[model samples]
Target: MDKNTIEILFSERKKVGLNLFEIMKEQGYTKISFSNRVKISRPTLNHLFEGEISSITTFEKYLDRIRDVLQVQEQEFLIGRRTAIGELQVAFSCNEPKGYHPGEREKEMFEILEDLINLCDFYY
Candidate 1:
């Protein structure tokens, strides 16, 4: 692939990352938890957001499986009240790094959110 084409692919991959973020947020998934769910490391997910593939071998092992995992996980997550909660504006606004792991408390918040979602799903 030419340099331009490679850059385009990287750009497209970033878009995918953003789309994945939206899906995750709707389902109350922080980056750390999503990485766990996807069975990929947090750094791998960050590299994906940065649109730079660090290891071809790693990609070969896991990249193709992401979609399949997402399908199954999405179904599980969608059992709760799912909707466009809001947008963070990170993609356009943040000038620094794009992906960051949630802190311990933040992760706890996500866990609480997940419990609430489960309750919502169970009740309705």
Candidate 2:
């Protein structure tokens, strides 16, 4: 997930909101019917379509339901940036050059931090 990919995902989500009403019209799905199908309240669906609330969980649930109904593959949802700052902090704290050789706990922490760093690089 580079910056360009993240931007594209955000753009798609915005487009989805705009197109949702059109899709509902094309599918002959009333507001109530779409709400029931997505297991969300009518007001919540309206807010989502209006872009009033940005709830990731709600959006994901709605999208999953819509994907199933439309026979489309589930789209990847982007939540936030991956900085790995916490992992970097932990990794720096794990440095015990004067203390001891790599023990089990140290090794585990190092491995976890390394993986986090790798993922951050891959996704950032």
Candidate 3:
């Protein structure tokens, strides 16, 4: 894609990151807890969430991690939250970051999210 296309996509991704923030808040997920659930460093998670990540690979990697953590489909996390805008965006914001590992229950949640994504793709 051209520079303009890439920029637009990146901007959209940032919006998705913002939406993910709302989801995390609703689910009672703090940066420290989320980083632990995703098994990523706090700084990297913060960079990803804030859209300050310069590397596309890093951005996508953390996005995938977040999708896993939230037990949401990738497309749902990125673009489908428009269906419930008001409920999803209720007074949500965060900046703090800290780290740890994804435990078995968290891994199960990720697997469920992945399965839902695949099921949606298969049916739709």
Indicate which candidate wins on lDDT.
3
lDDT against the true structure, each candidate? 0.55, 0.59, 0.63
Question: 59-83, model 3: which lDDT tens digit per residue?
Answer: 6666666766678765554553434
> Pairs clashing in candidate 1?
none
How far residue 99's Cα lies from its native spot in candidate 3, in Å, is 47
Global local distance difference test of model 1? 0.55
Clashes of 1: 0
Per-candidate alpha-carbon RMSD to the true structure: 13.3, 15.8, 15.4
Q: Evaluate residue 56 in candidate 3 and report its C-alpha lDDT on the 0 to 100 scale.
A: 64
Task: Between candidates 1 and 3, name the one with more favorable TM-score.
Answer: 3
Tens-place lDDT per residue, model 1, 56-117, is 44543454456566564322322333256544222112133568766788778767777877
**Worst-scoring 10-residue span by lDDT in model 3:** 87-96
Q: What is the lDDT ranking, best to worst?
A: 3, 2, 1
Lowest lDDT block of 10, candidate 2: 73-82
What candidate 3 gets wrong by more than 4 Å, as runs, is 1-11, 79-124
Report the C-alpha lDDT of model 2 over 51-86, residue by residue, as the tens digit: 555765556557667667755433323332233552
Q: Identify the superior model by lDDT, candidate 1 or candidate 2.
A: 2
Candidate 1 regions with alpha-carbon error over 4 angstroms:
1-11, 54-60, 72-124
> What is the overall TM-score of model 3 with all chains considered together?
0.51
> Is candidate 2 or 3 superior in lDDT?
3
